[model samples]
Target: MSAHSQHNLPPSLTGKGATLALDGHDLVRMTEEHGSPLFVFSERRLRGNARALRDAAKGGHARARIFFASKACSNLHVIKALREEGLNIEVNSGGELWKALSAGFAPGEIVFNGVAKSVPEIELALGHGIQSINVDSAFELSRIAQVAAGMGKRARVTLRLVPGIGGGATAGIQTGSEKSKFGMGQAELKEALATAKANAAHLDVAGMHLHIGSQVLDLPDFLESVRFTAEQAKAIGGELGKPLQHLNLGGGYPINYVHHNPGANAGREFDYTPYTATQSAAAMLGEVAGAAAKALGPDAEIFFEPGRAVVADCALLLSRIENVKRRGALQWLFLDAGYNLLIDAAAVRWYYHMVNASRIDAAPDTEFRMVGPLCDSADCYFDVEGEYLWADLQATLTGVAGVTPEILAALKAKVVRLPETRSLPAATGPGDTIALLDTGAYTLEEMFQYCGRQRAKAVMIGTDDRIVTLRDRDRPEDLLDAAERQGIVRTVAAE
Candidate 1:
């Protein structure tokens, strides 16, 4: 009945009876040395993920290339590690581009992507002569052309098209649909092509780009997106009187968060098994190679800008329980880590599989409502919106004609996101180290200082068994340094 026996753990984690280790490093010991609420990454796992995606790309298309999305985990160490693995970078802003350069990526190995690019951002990209600037709209294309003309340099550009294909587990993550504000529509694409033709003096139309969305679970949608993009590229190339150089299918490859779940209340949406990089590549590139060949030339390259799948499962967050409270029929366990550390949990009802690192081998047969240290009511791990809808539906349907328990149960299944309660070791309580798995991607990038709490530290376990600090924990005095620097407040010496 141990959680390890019931759950599908990531390859980086191994649970023994009283201990949980990440890539052979003890979690409890790590927390004891670095303090609770720490982020740990495995270099071996990271390399494995990068190599797997690279191999999958090569297997699908001989000319395929991967550009690691720096917005996912911009830790310089993480970026440098990926760079060492021969993965290029895709940056969303001027800052990420600078970081990519600092991480040792060549200017030609970087691509810039963003909807609203400021003048300075455009200038910085053109100054460096990066690979391609993904043009989000016709206006952006004009702005880039103007900037390039002023600088007397030709800019490499790609038109981002919205294929109207919606993918991703949540609505917030969908980007390729026509309604999303991410890419150019048919009319805008035409305008962009005309503008590019006119500005041939300052612009070189290198390729076409389309990103379906992040955490995409649908395979057929990818094929449809590729076909649509290929059709657009062919037309655009014909109008430009030359074959396009590449097609960048934005990355939204999904990662499996829930390995095993027995609770009936746990929604099926949370337990989805995602396709591997190998399978996804074959489906997207191999299945649509013929269409790509017919549109672009056989030597044309395929580019991928993956952010989450490459890093999501390479790390875990370790937190310690601070307090335990028992109410009438419910028990609540409070953790030191909260929305400040993992904002997606509260912001989007994101789920990260939790296990008791201090009681790894014990039977996880006890249910408890897990809450964070934040003062906000929505700071808990449960899905707040889903719970509210479920409760409201029950109250509204009561005493209505033809309202049956079976109907209510069926409705409840769709409304609930995460299980109302989490099962952990019966003795799990205060002082126990809890490990949250698959937190490598967006947690650090999205984390912030809330409730006057300092941000957590991050460490990496190298393949050589060396533990290196990626980031230092924020200190108490460090919190006030910002205010003092801005001249808003000053700290006085203690009497």
Candidate 2:
């Protein structure tokens, strides 16, 4: 069977089919136990994704290691579960490093990567014996060497090279361009390797790393990077007269979201088939390793840092309908969750499938536009005033059935002017339950406490079918306490 068919999610998810089980419990019920606008993760889904990645990396010449890029979603419970599945951890900052440590990952089981590595942070990683540092630039490498020398320790490092290929479901996620402040160029990396060899006492240059981009739907792009990276490794090893121990291929694998949950409207279905093909990831990794083995002498281990692909489908963002507004013939769902929780809206704009968790079997009776409760005009995910891509263009031609042909022509003309604008034309009313499905990755980590609203609670449904709170809902007191601790407020200020 095709990978798409094996993992294709449907238009609606029943309580039994759902890993998190939306139908068995209501958002209101969860809110009572936890709070509103909660994030729910499924242990079953997390494990499944982990295994899928593991399976794809098997049968290759190189030993494939999968690391959960904890920057995507860093809840301690979620991190711990990934650790249990034997996935290594990838951290972008010291706080994330701490979280990975707290989640029971030893320093050697962690790979640290970032642009600005503070002196203390490098010292911390060296102190803890992290697996390797994916160095961003030559300057950072020198800093690591200096820090490691101070402690009389040798730090293992990997150089992250920007492959100049940027791709993702959204434009904002593409980070492989030369303009991006991510990794080092070829010239800089060569110089750094020479330096590492010259001073082998302070630094152990273990491997070459390359992350083309994130959320890449194109498999060939990744394959090309892998081939090129393997070649670079061969060349560097020849020039330095020593083979590197690891080849880190940073992850950009996309997940199958439809299998997780359909949209807020039960009637509308999302196409999830294109992404889940096992052969896609498998074939690409195999080809790359085959070439690398021939060139690099078959001894280096391959590492993959898959963040979004592992966790994106394992969680759902549950929000109650604070109010529903109807404008003309459109139905608008004003959800409690906004750009704060779903921060993807800050850059790439795409509609996450919203589903009526309360009414799973409801017919396709309503056509509507979904909106978030953020006060800013552009704060919501969808721009109602912008251009739209209507699945049924014929239905959009009519608004209340009295609109004339001339008006329809004008609207069509406007839509043509901005071809990429995607808007929802229909309005929805209040008191409905709406959900943003497959929001497990990057959503929670990017959350900001905007509008004085506290962060929402996060719940996880275990393999035992019981619900547990991953994080308690943030309260006003909690925010105030944090402020006081940060010296943003005085004790008398609260009084």
Candidate 3:
């Protein structure tokens, strides 16, 4: 299979055993060209997704700047591609800030976000002269003003507010909760804006920002947030006697993964899109923008910082199978990637839908208890309703890496162990290939080396079916090199 064909792997792939065909090339091609346990991103799909979001916001009238949340897919290459398309950047941390900067994102084109900003980090941003920092607290505003005054520069600050409407289905992620630690309250925001006005000579209050939460599926929740933001801006304008320059409704739009389906193995579905047609989450955003214009007048520019929805479907993770064993009725299927590579799996119970990349239309007739190669027992993606099968002597493992801790715990508790088998065939031995689907977001930055294992490799498939190594697999020597830089001097005198 070629790279283009593999990149176009269908939504539902079916075949006996764990076979992965990405773009057009099967797991064999991916492994030979790139390497196993590789993160392959589709450039065509990425640009298309970005363009969709931009079009959604503009409604074909004017261009609406869409900032790719670097926190989602912070790979420099990923950032570079998005930047090339004229998409702005939204960064959550100093590391992401550096990535965006290295990817050629202009200082003025980036939006610095996050509730907690360290002094040194803030100083770095102040020095770099990024466009605006979304201030979460009155104290942050004070710090920015102080830092800006010290540097003899003005800080473009945006106040992040809690819209009071919970976002996403997960109660824990809903940032709009009054109890959440995300944005500044209305009272604090008022005081912060007042303080900014008092220090207008040193601080420039750029806009008001809000990120309700991630994986938000409900359009009304976002629209309501927009309306609330517009209303608040209007009230603030009344106090300041000027309409704010920017109103950023942060992105948390949901994507429909295979996990949305029922069953224990369907994985954890946080953001579910029951519909996927003409009126999508993007359309809802446009409606929200129109509503904001109505409430806050036409001058206020509404900004959206969407991360997952843009990159989720644009990338996939391909892994190779190592072993398959059956403990009593429980089947243990091991792969090459684990939580170390999928940092998000440690916290968020997000499961990327997986299927044989080779069998685009394969039926969901079999299931398996999928586990990674990590020594930790918590690393597993067990599907209670899924069965494992192998045919054609192709011994390969395929599935998404980075199963969330929540789901792993459930797997640990035997929530997805195989049921009594009537006449199931014996499992295949090692040497099979498995692939994980829709892992484009935060996998790379999250992956860490643990237990002295090899660092995973990253590959990119080009328009010409050529495979380019994005990040090479780490060797034991690489670890020693890293350790040497950490000032760990070797024992000169032998014991």
Candidate 4:
């Protein structure tokens, strides 16, 4: 809301002075009405992203579908909203499978994915007759066969090949590499396919799939992985005497997260545009489709599983400052929420732009340390290395003896070198709200009951321009339900 300059702001945010807005609604008022430490999602943004992906596919292959990655977000309302746009779903586990079903996704529209699938979950997937079970390992392929045999069902599958490609924002999220714990190596995947083909009584190795990790910045690497997957599919189909029916070039589109990095891409600093200006979905589809036609032959149905691109910029976390402290020369700002609300930020050093919601117009002159309410030292906004967790400022409590002002300024300058830094007004204090931008994806799926901090409320600005509660804030009893099950108290747990 700064009148100084409005450049590089996200499309969903607007307003001047102390009143920053989302979908035209004042965030301060929304927080007051819904409660602080909340997640506010823009339905408009969600639909736009979904449509952009679908459009990209249609434009590229003339027949493209997005199996919306359900693990990125599990909210029923959010799921239902995206499903209504004609997008399908991809679930990583039985719990997510249930949520997808509960969200009104048809069996044929749901694709189950995971490294390990328990017997009950496998049975559940078979019972529902989901679209396809993406087999991650040879053992998992055999496990599916056993379960399907017992259930007297024919389970469709796509072998997930590890191309050993790695390019992601963090090592934790890179799934397509052999160094990662997801999917199977190419030789193992080929062997699994042969085994499945041999045991055709219960399993059908009908397709090939490969994901070259997430946060992919280099488009060429991703395309190469796609080509490799198709080539593998052709080789396997010829060896197994079967035609591959589908190919899943899994989703890994990069979103701009760095807000102030010089020479960085434009609109990355709080930019929320869903589709690329030149790199359209049609372009990506055309590239993959052409490759598949050459290697796997024509009629290779295309599929993608987009999680981050569809929802990463659709929501924000609204937190309030509980205290601002200075010890010696260090300045600190403590928020009401912790890593419990957004685990990825703390665990993997994920970057999300922060704003002083209460005073968006004020010059961000303050360089205070940022911390969360969690007693654990790991719950700060800075990286896991704890590089900027504290100021080096040291002065006598008597105020008579203090560090040199010039030295203190130099140290503060060093803190700014880290990936994320917000310049909130110097007056920021208790009750002042902070908005963590670009939090729609990954945050909800990883939220936990750490320190018994209940999950916050999530409100949505609906398509009709009306506000409604998509999910109620987690109550205290929700967290205690698990502990109470151990006979620590009377035991009627959620399960």
Candidate 5:
């Protein structure tokens, strides 16, 4: 009847009676020391993920390069650890570029990628001589060329082509569709290539790049994307009269998030059979070997910019239940952590498996409506939008003519996002520590300070069994420090 016996816990997590340990460190004790609403990352998992990805890439192609997408988890310690494992860095903004440099990544080991690259960001990349700037559009290409011309430097550039292929869990994350505002289409790409050739003095066309989407579960979509990119590379090389130096197959490798339990109402909408790094690499490299090799030659490198796959499952968020309420036949458990800490949960209705850390061995026979401390109604873990739509549909169809029960059931199935309830220990309530699993990626990076709640602290469990603080808990003054710096608010001391 224990939770572990019923649920598939992550590899780094183990549960015993009244205790939940992450890689042999007790979660309850850590929460007691560090306070609730904390993030704990496992160094062992981070290094393992890096090694697995690197080895997988090498298995597919000898000249493969893996770049840890730092925008996923920009904590300096995490970046340094991945770098030590022989992965380069991929950044999206000037701030991320600076973080990459501060993390000790050489300019040659970094690649800048973004849609809106300001003048200052372009200058910083050129000044440091970063490996390549992944150009998002034709206009950006001309802008980069102009900036490089002004800087008196030849900027290495890669065209981010839109393969017109789209695959992702949600529309918000889908970046490769024809309508998506991410990369250049065929006409724009042709224009970019011509512009690069024209501005040969300032722009060095190094390679081509395309990102299908994040959390893409379809392997055939990857194969199709790789095949398309390879074909384009071949034609591009022929047009330019020189082979490409690299092919940046931007990463969207998925990771398993749902841990199934027969007795629990864990949402199945987020579940997918994620491809292993090796499988993804092989699919891409296999396509590359066919046509792309004929143009780029054997020495051409293959680059992967993995973000979520590298870190999503390597950490968990620990939250404390601060209050409990019961209405009719339902129970609600409110935790201290909310959209401010894990924005995706509210923004996209993202799901993270919840575990009762305080009662690890207890049977999860009770279903509770789990919610965060945020004042907003959408702050709960359930799909708020989906629930609203379902309710509206039911009300609309209540007296509609010829609306059969079967039809209503079918409509409800399509409208409802699963796991409308959460299964937890029956005794779960106030003061209980709940561990939200697989929250490593996107949570802290997208965190915001809303409703005056201070941001939480993060700690890493080192491979050496030492717990190091990755980030300190935000102080009350830290909130106003930004306003103070901008002169929006002046502190009159000792008034």
Candidate 6:
């Protein structure tokens, strides 16, 4: 009779008695053997998400190609799985490019994108002959030209533009507005293209890249950006003395994390709906193509970079309950997986639907305040950035009535909200594994060790039901400093 028993659970999870299995593999056994606080990814779901995005983008434009955002989840195995589904790789840095190459992503199938690319990173990207490098700023474009010319290779690139559109549930994730640190404005875009044309011997301007934002729910935002891109692309080839070859629209299609579908929060047990993208990828892509088909024509191919939408729902974080206690009219549950492992919990207050995997079918009738393992008070599992709570935390902490922008950001980044009361089962306790749903994106790569905890294992349910380790759980030695790995270990004798 509980909504938590059904809607919040992912498609790959099915209940059998008290056990919840993922694709016929027991989750409890998985946590036991592989260790607690593990990342369990569904290969089936990864492929399905990729195919769905590809289908969506190609619906209107058959030449549409998808580039999986590597910053979402850079696990080599996961990257390869997504690539097999017809998605190419788009990396944000040199490390990601290295991993993409190791995963066997062809040079032409990869794209390098970042604001502050180092000389060595540019050299590496050019040397590898990746598909295209998105130039974030004019300075970066000049730097790329130098690197490419020195390497005796033509650096293929696209101009990333700020189109005055915003996205994401929070301001932090919104990337396309004028306030954003990424991409060039219209004037800058024209200048950058002219610069690339003048230096055609080193840098080649492929097309323009526009991303209104990440976690976008509305289709109109995308359509506006697409039209703007086509308009820009119309002017690009003329300036560069050649036709535009591709248009890269960076991906920000949101995934509904809390409710089964976006905007279904009314009857839901929890009040969390990250954002909504009402149209399917194919539907949205169709509309964009329809809007831009005239200006872009057939020659300029379309490219989509989908990071969160492709991988965010393919995996979930599995952690065991470590302890339970009462704290001032609230029940506090300590989780082995906390903000350290799930950075979004504390970073931008990104919510992930939680279900007790050990009792996945049990009725949820209790509320608990989830706490992480860190010593910092700011390390709790929830953040309160609402209007009233901001006032309350500010007034209570510093006794200030009105606040400044600097103080507001600081408090928002580090404030104790209501701690997100979850209606988990009454029997949820220590050793029971808690499944955080739709965590396949940005969780693993952003994870860190704050409370001296080593990073967790990323285990995949391979084809034919085989359990393969995509990434190893960090051993104590892995997290140790030079002194500890040598001198400290030698000093501490085992009895």
Best by lDDT: 5
Whole-structure CA lDDT of model 3? 0.68
**Mind giving the per-residue lDDT tens digits that candidate 4 earns over 1-495?**
342253245768876457678888889888899887999999999999888778767656644568998888888989999999989999999999999999899999998988888989999999999889998889888889988888899899988888878766557778877888888886787679677877799988878788876676666776788668767877878877877878888887766664443222222122222222234333554565555445545477788887888888889999999887786665788998888988876777666667777877776655556788997987887644534343323332224355566655455444323333346677888899888888998887678888878888988899899987877888867876665746655444533
- Could you list the CA RMSD of all candidates, in the order they appear? 2.8, 6.6, 8.5, 6.9, 3.0, 4.6
TM-score per model over all chains: 0.93, 0.82, 0.82, 0.86, 0.93, 0.89
Candidate 6 C-alpha lDDT tens digits along 97-152: 99999998999999888889999999999888889999999889998998888888
lDDT for model 5: 0.84
For each candidate, how many residue pairs have backbone atoms clashing (under 3 Å)?
Answer: 0, 17, 33, 4, 0, 3
- What is the overall TM-score of model 5 with all chains considered together? 0.93
lDDT of 2 at 69: 88
Better of 5 and 6 by lDDT: 5
| Residue-level lDDT tens digits of model 3 in 1-495 | 322232333442223233554455566566666667778877777777777788777772243567788888787777787887778999988988988888898998999999889888888898999988999899889988888888898888888888888876445567886688888887898789788888887788768888888777777787788778878877777777767788888888776554333332232322223212224556666776666666656666668898888887777787776887878665666778777777554445445555444333333334456677888765665322322322111122223355555654444333222222111123423555456677887777777778777778887665566766668888766767656745554443332
lDDT of 2 by residue, 170-209 (tens): 4456667677788988888877887787778999888888
TM-score of 4: 0.86
> At residue 350, what lDDT does model 1 achieve?
77
Ranking by lDDT: 5, 1, 6, 4, 2, 3
Q: What would you estimate as the lDDT of candidate 2? A: 0.69
